[model samples]
Target: MLGRRATILSFDLDYPALYYPADSGSLAGQRRFVRATRVRLFALFAAALGGAWSWRAGSFDLFGLLGFVAFAIALGAATYLQATDPARSWYEARTASESIKTLTWRYIVGGDPFPLSLPETAAEKLLRARLAAVIDPDKLPAPSPSAPTKQITDRMRSVRASSFEDRRAAYRDGRIEDQRGWYARKAVANERLKQTFTWVAIALELAGFVGAAFKAFGQVDVDLLGVFSAAAAGLAAWTQARSYADNQRAYSRNAYELGLIADELDGVSKADWPRFVDEAENAISTEHTQWRAAKGLGAPRQRNAASAPES
Candidate 1:
């Protein structure tokens, strides 16, 4: 019975209207920020190389022109970064996306502050209010004209109206297990990325050291040291910006925590289910809180205290 119902019900179809737009905005902003940062780094590296080459060439017009163009590219990238502030957009949009996603899961699973005992009308109203409270209109992009209008879908209502066993099964399988798998995958990916970047940085440093040694022996007419040094510095800056190591640690911790929470789900009674769900949600929220903190977004909002429905 639970398997049949789960097959029919879909979280994607029932997600709130605002979530898609916020998610899109977050992704676009992230891409823009990454592209701009890379462009700036590359431009600076080119400028350093150009300057070094010009010096070695005794102020040749061609090398001077290359340096001028490189500086111009760097300046343009910096100006674009300042004007767009893609990082801020990415963070705020991500906040809205995650908040809506968490609330949607809570509502569908009949979790705390959105229990199945509440009247349907009251529950919908509370969900809407909570959604509004979490989203800042000015920070997020406008919803597309084709975006879904219904915030609470019929599938969501059906899931909420399911028996305790079905609801528990659905939440456990759909939410907890899914999230745990995602976190585990992300942790592995981030760890690989961290190691890759670290090795690349080390290689660049070694190259710079070799260039310096060669320069000291007067074996090369052109100074490769300055160029390699600039490349190393750029790699370091990019690695810091990516925060691969931090994300790897955070994702691994969250994956383990979610595994533990999933283990506790089977023993929860109907009466204790709501509290258990809240606890699980809190664990998930902790990961997001760490994410926001790493991005310098201050503390997570007190969602239960600030947006809980009135008795």
Candidate 2:
């Protein structure tokens, strides 16, 4: 059992069929949202620059025309965003993908609500129901034509059928350790991004202040105060949309909690493993819960932890 790999197939047409498409949709939607936001902000800056140029050059026909064009572009971008609602797609797809992933982990690792003691048929049925519950039919993407159709892959069964020690090892290494490391890395990345954007916004604001002071004192001919202020406002909007600081805090806290949970794995006995796994899963779920809350997603579906059955 130790010689066999415990990894789940990414191309398996079961839960992954649902998972992959939702994940892709979420990424695509996120990219779209970011691109639209950037375009709008850039247009706004361009409009401000054109206005400043028009004022300095005393040519309303040229620079004023450019400002009007830029304003039109910004309006178009805003209309596109409002019509498509990419942010909503990003959030909904992400929510579906995460919910499916958590259910898959629980099913594979013989975690609560899908314990080893349950008959295979019953467990499979429960898993299917849970998967169906998390996703809306309208949002469910079509499965790839070439993908395999097995929900419970041979590898998942192999891991499930392994000795208690092997299963414990597999779950610890594959799930807990992987998640802890991922959260730790994300925490650092988000913190760095937050700091970078924060500094950029501050720098823009400072430049805007200096430009305004210069204009007031007649030290500079060009009116760049509006340009700098518009740019600063754009940066502030992007930073707020990203929520980098909130993510950094949540990821750091989750990583620390997972570390504490990992330490307790070795002490868990066969009979206690189910409950322990549930606890660890709940710890992971907490981060997702916090994420949903931050996104203004009211609440996720309620799933009570099943009592651990005798091993």
Candidate 3:
């Protein structure tokens, strides 16, 4: 086995209990962070350009047309990255969960041969030696085994079955986490969207003011254009405020899910740990119920919310 003594990474004693591995997981996190930053920069650029054009055009009607285009492009980028990088997300999630699993497993199954937790310093040399004695380098558990023989067949089958269950649970958690992150990102975009709308509203209101002044001075046609411009300013302001409220509600729901996941991770040693697997299954069912409720809610108010743009 090609191996070196593993160094202990820093630990977060917070509720979530994040554990950093001094291995490949750390590098993967840095890489993901860099990629997300780049994508956000691109979205910001598109939003800025769209905002500027809508302001210059002096028509509230045009705002919707341009904003949708920008939103589509940014959303497309996010969707593509997520679809292509599912495993990366899985690894990231597993990184945290795996650390907890190792610690909790040791706590559950006593007389642990391997190190229960990574040792931090030379002073922990005794712990290092203890861990090394039981560290089985040649038999790392994975989703599947490469070679199947009679000797390893039963163990491999057990691993495969456990892997499937783990994957299913992990996927459920990932879906909720992704929803949380997406709602957060959407809130950020909504802030920018509101700002864009505010600027346009201000510009339109100013143009309307100018038009009224010009009409007083007998300059140009100030009929429907002037009236609609004033209305647009008020309408934009109302929509921004309403959307902000909706966004807050959406974020609250997502935050709840995130907290649930973090709690589940931290309490791996709870007497009711395996019950979490059952809870996860129930949670999936609960989500389906919530979706149906939302659909029912929309069915009645669809036309009303559509007209008001408050949905």
Candidate 4:
């Protein structure tokens, strides 16, 4: 029993870690890439401003050199850190992580293909194979073998082998309740991002108008008006690049869907419990898979992201 528990726990940790790599590993690569990309973008804009300032001040050499360096840095980031790709890594990693999560949910709930009629060893092998096939290496390669281990607590194993009431309660708290909260929070976040970026873009446009007015009255150089225009354009470009509005709409829709799912599961009958679990888990996986496809990250595969394992 001891050995069996360890084996199950190890697989739980290992499979999720295969592509996405849970815990701090998830944040590290993404954080590094985001910061690096931002640095490069800021430098590019700063370079444009510097060049304008240099021309106005007749200090050509210094600003020209700065602009060249900024351009080079942006190119380097695009090449090495994949700075040009918007949310590709995020979507890929998140898809893999969520797929593993769905697999675990189905396994614990003992719904559909889980709790095989086959022997323990064969069942475990099938589970791992199905999971491995789900991870798409085309978007993001697998993590290093030396990737940090995920600590599998006693709860995952116990829950997997638990009684009906225990499993149902765990599903109630961990799946339905938790997912509702997550969807709500993410919806709010996306809305906030959209609203904030929209306001910032409007402010930039106002600034540009003010600058253009001043230049028309000959109160400032025409070149200064160009600076404000560039800033306004940059704000609009950034808003589109981030897809803040689209994400806001998507999150809002998903949150409403999850709310309905949660409500339907309230006091579910045992006879109908398995089907409920099936629908709930499928809803979660389908949401992520749809998000993946919207972002164009996992659409090229012969198998849809949800069908890869969770379907």
Give the best candidate by TM-score.
1
Please identify which of the two predictions, 2 or 3, would achieve the higher lDDT against the true structure: 2
lDDT of 2 by residue, 220-260 (tens): 87787888988888888888888899999999999999999
Q: Pick the candidate with the highest lDDT.
A: 1
Worst 10 residues of 3 by lDDT: 302-311
TM-score of 1: 0.90
Clashing residue pairs in candidate 3 are: none
Comparing 1 and 2 on lDDT, the stronger one: 1
TM-score, candidate 3, is 0.34
Clashes of 3: 0
Relative to the true structure, how large is the alpha-carbon lDDT of every model? 0.82, 0.78, 0.41, 0.61
For model 4, the superposed segments whose C-alpha errors exceed 4 Å read 1-29, 55-61, 81-87, 115-123, 136-154, 300-311
Q: 1 or 3: which has the higher TM-score?
A: 1
- Please give the lDDT score at residue 59 for candidate 4: 50
State residue 253's C-alpha deviation in candidate 3, in Å.
4.5
- Which consecutive 10 residues in model 1 have the weakest lDDT in total? 1-10
Residues 1-311 of candidate 3 have per-residue lDDT tens digits of 01222222221111111222222343554455446445544554455444434343565646445656756776765676566563344333333333333332222222132122322232133322322332233222221233221211232223223443453334334433544565577667766766776777677677667767877788754343435453564455445424554555555565576567656654454244444443443443343334334423211111112121111
The backbone clash count of each candidate, in order, is 0, 0, 0, 0
TM-scores for all candidates: the values are 0.90, 0.88, 0.34, 0.77
Worst 10 residues of 4 by lDDT: 1-10
Report the lDDT tens digits of candidate 1 across residue range 179-288.
89889999999999889988988898898889889889998766688888899899888888888898889889999999999999999998887778888998998888
